[model samples]
Target chain A: MSAGSPPGVVLDPWLSGVARLVEEGFDQLDLLTAVDLPRDGVIEIVIHLVRIEDHAHVFGHVRLPRADPVLESVTSILPAAAWHEREIHEMFGVEISGHPDLRPLLLQSTSGPPPLRKDTPLVARVETPWPGAVEETTGRRSRRAVTPPGVPPEWLGEGS
Target chain B: MTQRCYAVADRPEVRVHIRDLGLACCAVEFASAIARGLLIPAPEEPGTAAVLVISGTVTDALVPEVVRAWEALPEPKAAVSFGACSNSGGPYWDSYCVTKGVDTVIPVSTYVPGCPPRPEALIDALVSLVVPV
Candidate 1:
């Protein structure tokens, strides 16, 4: 539960620890965010508390059951945490139970699964990586010529 | 800085009022061109002499906005698909939100191709607008 270095402990349910950190004079919520670990079937939420006066940083990690993860909003403790909570709700699909405005942040008005989820497929076509072989003179074989397999040649010609 | 006016009566170097519809990285180049005086912002109200210069990976959410802007520009309006994103989905062609191309939504007069076209390259496209054959 404790941080890797300095000194800290991972609170079972960060809701209370968020309050405890505020009580200990860590007035600034440096960052509140979550990560999607599909392999673990959990969303890991991490909150960082900073005391500018002492330049102390305390990071707390909490894992929620990805199937139906939920957590109390920390906005009550740190209003600034509201945006980050909303971000996690959308990106990691973690439910911030008491968030006043869980409305979309970076994702404009749209509905879909969290884009950050490990399993979430990239919706955009990435650039075709440069092929390692220098001279790939177009002489068709089984597949297309321009880009190698796995790389889309959609960007190759005037049209796909 | 080049000036272009598409006025039928006066043709006083028509100002290029560009309504930028950004989808991704190319928006940066679009902004830079504006800084170089290659383009100008459209008036507060729609239906002015303008071009809907779309760049980057456009998501499905922005289709209606593009249509609305294109319809609003006063007659003699043109569209410039300024990046790979708009010409095709660009690299993001595979994305769920990215629209395959701008031509699907509106007529494109000029197509500037690049992952994110450079400011100078965009100037070339803008030049095509301002300069007459």
Candidate 2:
């Protein structure tokens, strides 16, 4: 079978869309994850549902604005979405309203910006002098130090 | 590095109780080693545990808990940074969430180096700690 795009559903109707799929025999929640789209200023929520009887699959994508990324909790309908929603909330900074227990899921720090958000700088790389950087300079004329990914150049004092 | 005598008086007979802080994959290796008799599992009480084996990545969030675990052990207690992650944060040294090393949070007497050091390596580290030869 050829691959196809999952049907996109707006945030307002996201809960209903998932409920409809469940009613249509998609009983298993195989995966639920989020994609950070900085350029588009949106966070994409992707979900894969599986039907136990025939092993059929259904996919749904929901776009949420970066500024106000909030969605009604799907735990009431899928139950298993609780952990996934908690992870998304912590990493992507997306708020999952009405979640029974939306406490911190994985990450220990709650002070820093959501780690998975596109704009969150990877502080560890910035603070710790990378050992590999020393190895690169030992053999020959060293190239300009490249800023680590997810860290803004200005934060590293590389900006004029 | 403040030097302290780690050798227990009754080296061979004294059961080296272990307070396991299994955070990640190293915990799996540690457990396997214990199950296969490569390493001995000791008493559950932290007061009796001579060694606090921190097995895996030590994150900044867990710093307080790690420190508390170390403090709970009785005097002459030693800590083992079980794997590379706990040693120098392993591959997660650059991870925003991971603490560079477990030593940063607690005093570690021995550091077993490996992505997940073989259980035999852990046994060797513990032997060196108690026997002091």
- lDDT against the true structure, per candidate, is 0.71, 0.78
Question: What TM-score would each prediction reach against the true structure?
Answer: 0.68, 0.76
Q: By summed lDDT, which 10 consecutive residues of candidate 1 chain A come out lowest?
A: A151-160
lDDT of 1 by residue, B56-97 (tens): 776778888778878876665778898888998877666766
The TM-score, computed over Cα atoms with residue i paired to residue i, of candidate 2 is: 0.76
Give the local distance difference test score of model 1: 0.71
Best model per lDDT: 2
**Residue A107 local lDDT, model 1:** 79
The docking quality of candidate 1, as DockQ, is 0.40
